[model samples]
Target: MSSTAERQGGSPGGHPRGLYFLAGTELWERFSFYGMQALLTLYMVKQLLLPEFAENVWGLAALRGMAEGMFGTLGNVGFASVIAGLYSGLVYFTPLLGGLIADQLLGAKRTVTIGVLLMSAGHLAMTFDQLFVVALVLLILGSGLLKGNISSQVGTLYPQDDASMRDRGFAIFSTGINIGAAAGPLVTGAVAAIWGWHAGFAVAAGLMLVALATYLAGQKHLPDTPPRRHADFQHPPLSKADGKVVLALIAVILLTMPAEITYPMVWTIGPIWVDSYVNLGFVPATWFGSMDSIGAIASAPLLVMFWASQARKRREPDSLGKMAIGTGLVGVAALGLAAGSFIFPAKDSVPLIWAIACYFLMGVGWMYYWPTTLSLVSGVAPRAVVATMVSGAFISPFIAHLAAGVIGINFKRMSPSAFWAMDGAIGLAGAVLLFALRPMLNRALGTDKRKDAPENAF
Candidate 1:
């Protein structure tokens, strides 16, 4: 009944029908998720809220976006563009917590299902303007579950030392996410713009449902079993020493985000809020959101090719090392945004290409970070902690987003350049954090560079 047997024990690349089914499910789920994600900030400022502080900053951003689009140019604004910076920043932060839960409690299969379901509900909830905040809470929580665990499962499909195939496998998996991102916004935004915002949420919900059903259909094929992990409430919690370690870990994470936290003070109120301006018909706005996704999509083949290029080398960077470099470079990309502001000061918006370049670089950088990280975690993490780690990784992005919305929103209203600069610093800090943890990773997983290391697995 296992996939190996289903394909008559063929290689994973030639996995049985269920693998494709799982892949399809993920593709659809990502479509719903990214579609809604594409429009969130815009919707927040334009349609969801009123002419309050939140709306003001968002409104200005929208106006700026409109003006630049009209004149065929984008500009940098006064005060940090905290809202934009924070939203972008957060989407990555929450994953740490999400990944942990998946590794320790939910297991890959259940976590993904529950997370996807929650996200689907969250999207549906957003359709209710009155319940906007509640919807956000649900979406963040749901993402914490689904985003981290599902990715880990993809890694779990193979053995840990199977280096030759892991990168290619992840490359295949990441595409499902990009495919969703590429199509989601265009379709959902068009629907929402022509029909209503609620329609967008509804479409997202429908897509998630399809993903969910698709997941269920192949339930028999998934090797992971999580229900057993979370059913252990009788067990005592970690010791005080462990608790302190967890607290310290959190402190480190928090300190890494100061610019991210502090910048929103001005933008929410000053002159640039979105309600204070006009809306650019849906297409361009949605298209702008699609930029990061496009970057993500563009990276898959490129990274896979890069991995292939390394084949001739005696010491190829392992998944972990590549992830480290990728994430660190993401920091560099953020810095590029700061540099962009310097290049084009006081215009209505930063050059579209500047933002686009940032997105593209970021996509290439971060694209390699997670897929590889997941493979490493699945490879070396003790079975007991695998789901937990996944949950934490997933949760980190949610954490990033939650903070982004609360603080980044306010920051964008204040100083724009500072916003871009802050994200660059954050990306760098995340890279450093991983680098610092390199010893732990190296010890447990074996070096990614060594061809003699363990088999490359899921």
Candidate 2:
């Protein structure tokens, strides 16, 4: 369907039918991904890395030796954190390759299909103890293929001029992400607790199959991929202006990395923290990983409504402003953790309310920045390289996860308050830098002219 037709003939709720389908695909994909992620660190620390199980996994010894050689001796938790960081970081990093493949070779649809199949295989591989590393590799490769292309397609669902609708559409799509993220850990964690970890992985594999089916069912509704081009592909030259815009986008992405670095702690070491220090009664520690998603899911609609109201009053912050605000909020959330640690120094003494508050703030921060970043890229990126740019945007998270991993190694060595305070400092510094660089960024991104214009004018 043409973008014009899709927009004009949108569903009763005024969105293209394909949006929901894509969102549904993302929902299931995230369900599987997050389900596995919620289990990964805990599984490693408690089961997989133990001598009885670790010896069974092929090549694990070599992998451990290599990691230790680079980062010094790592006990089980520290090693798990590093592996989780590498896995998480690589997951985002691969999108750059996936984007290129989609743009130059296979086109988005075919690439996405391949991604889904690989991810499904990865999830199934998780069912076998010996296939742990193999499973991670498959999942990373598959995510690299799927993430950027799927998101790029969402931008194609709307008329190029309809930036407002497109932004709202991304918000809606992100809602699907949070929904799956919220539910995945809850369901899978419970399953693992009751029936063991492999059973949880089996469930993820099943959900991934459902994601593939959803994408297939919606294929006709999705935008058709343009024919792949290979001749002179190595150098798709751009105008001077487009080149500047690309550089500006990269800067913005880099500035966002500090906030990104703060994010993985909630998943990588978060479960372990909760398991060791929080009094949860019967609740699984992995359930804490879902708190941010739940907060995001609840707040998304309210945020959209709030932004809409501001738009009507001609007082809405621009995308850059929103991002700065988001980054600040993430920093504040981290500070909240630091405060909790200081006040409740005894193990498991931290109030549950404090952790919940931290996750809630982080969720709000994510909503403010992430969707805005996606919408900005979709709207302003040169058409020739939009998909590639979208994928490149994910590089922030890639950098963040790698850094987070390195920083996480200190989790065992430092006091909780000190560690969290350091993270808070990083996020706050990024927010300050982004705010200071706003004018330069706006001019470079060519958004200076639209600063005082209507939100839709962009």
Candidate 3:
């Protein structure tokens, strides 16, 4: 899926090599992402402390007898929750800086490399307790650069006429993310468990190095998918009316991020009011935050195919329509959160099935939300700054998180039930806004389907 659809040079075994470059790069990139996720929390709560192996070390003695239990000598919940949420949250939030470096100076390729190097360095830095703060910074920066740019490059592989392949490309790109996320944990978790968390970072760096090597080896395959230069891509002619629509979308995204961040940041505010309403809030918070990813993983391929089929029938959803629905569903998922909290009452875990159900429902909803936004952004952005535009897409969440962290810390005094309800209410607002703007979006961007185009469904 390169920019040029001419497919010169004998089709390279019937498909462009850029696909492999993206596929491999993403695979390794996800490994790093997931690796960090698996161990990040444990690292912060346990590894960074004086006894690196306290959980395993301390728990080993208690295990002389039969069953596994939640309690023994354990880290404090509030402090640990903050650390875990912040680490995961910051990774999303800091991409703003990463996106900037990539756009202005590094380009996606170099940006990814620098990010990986920093990641490896950060992982290594974990060995020194004093360096933990610095290590976290590097890891966040690396993820920010790598996450947004790599996907942008994937889109760059196709020309505007080729919208059909976008979904497929995103699907493949996302697969790389999941693969990395899934593997990073399995591999790093084991390594950290036995050798040390530092060892896991070393392994993550090695994976990134390998990913880079794979990209280099496959560079020739991506000749048609050359890095986008500024000044080529142009915005669709924007009149005052069109400009208003664009502004509206910006507003929608801005509002959406805080709501999105709240899914993960709930506990930050829940404690003050949670005791009065639900017995245990973590169960719901974790479920909602984690639901999006798990849902993305589960539904990506299925939704891609479904959308492709719709496009074939010429009944495809335009970008705005997709966003509208996706946004609505996110809001709907928030309602589910509200209900579960209500049903559980007095600090209890909602039925495990409720969490699973929420994950599945939200997963499908996000499937529509993210790729559609990306496709819409691609359609509207000037080709010259599409890289930067895409970088901005990644940056939006970071900005949102900075706001969320502050808001979350302060919002705790409110009731937990009210808190969950408010989250749902906001998502609904985004959906409505996006839906209302659909006509403008369709007029601005043209049809969303390019089924016969070089780009595949993302």
Pick the TM-score winner: 2
lDDT of 1 by residue, 365-430 (tens): 756665565555555444544455444443444455445444444333444457656756766776
lDDT of each: 0.58, 0.87, 0.58
lDDT of 2 by residue, 216-270 (tens): 9999888887646776455467999999999999898898898898867888988
User: What tens-digit string does per-residue lDDT give for candidate 3 at 1-458?
Assistant: 23365432454443345776778887887776666555554454444443444333332233312111422233333334444455666787567676667666667777776776777676666555556667777777777777666666676666656677656666666677665654566676567657877787677767877876776776555533234455855466656755554565465456456335544443233332332343333332211223346667877778768878888866666666676677677677767767877777555555656645654566667667776676667666655444545556654565654444444432344444565677677778877767666655444544433444323322
Q: In model 2, which regions exceed 4 Å deviation?
A: 1-16, 157-169, 230-237, 451-458
Question: Which whole-number lDDT from 0 to 100 does residue 105 have in model 2?
Answer: 83
Output the lDDT of residue 245, model 3. 45
Query: What TM-score, over all chains together, does every model reach?
Result: 0.67, 0.91, 0.69
Per-prediction backbone clash count: 95, 1, 27
Looking at model 3, residue 73 earns an lDDT score of: 31
Least accurate 10 contiguous residues by lDDT in model 2: 449-458
Error of 1 at 404 (Å): 3.8
Clashes of 1: 95
Instruction: Name the runs in model 3 displaced over 4 angstroms.
Output: 1-13, 38-108, 155-167, 182-206, 209-213, 216-249, 262-291, 305-317, 345-349, 382-385, 410-419, 436-458
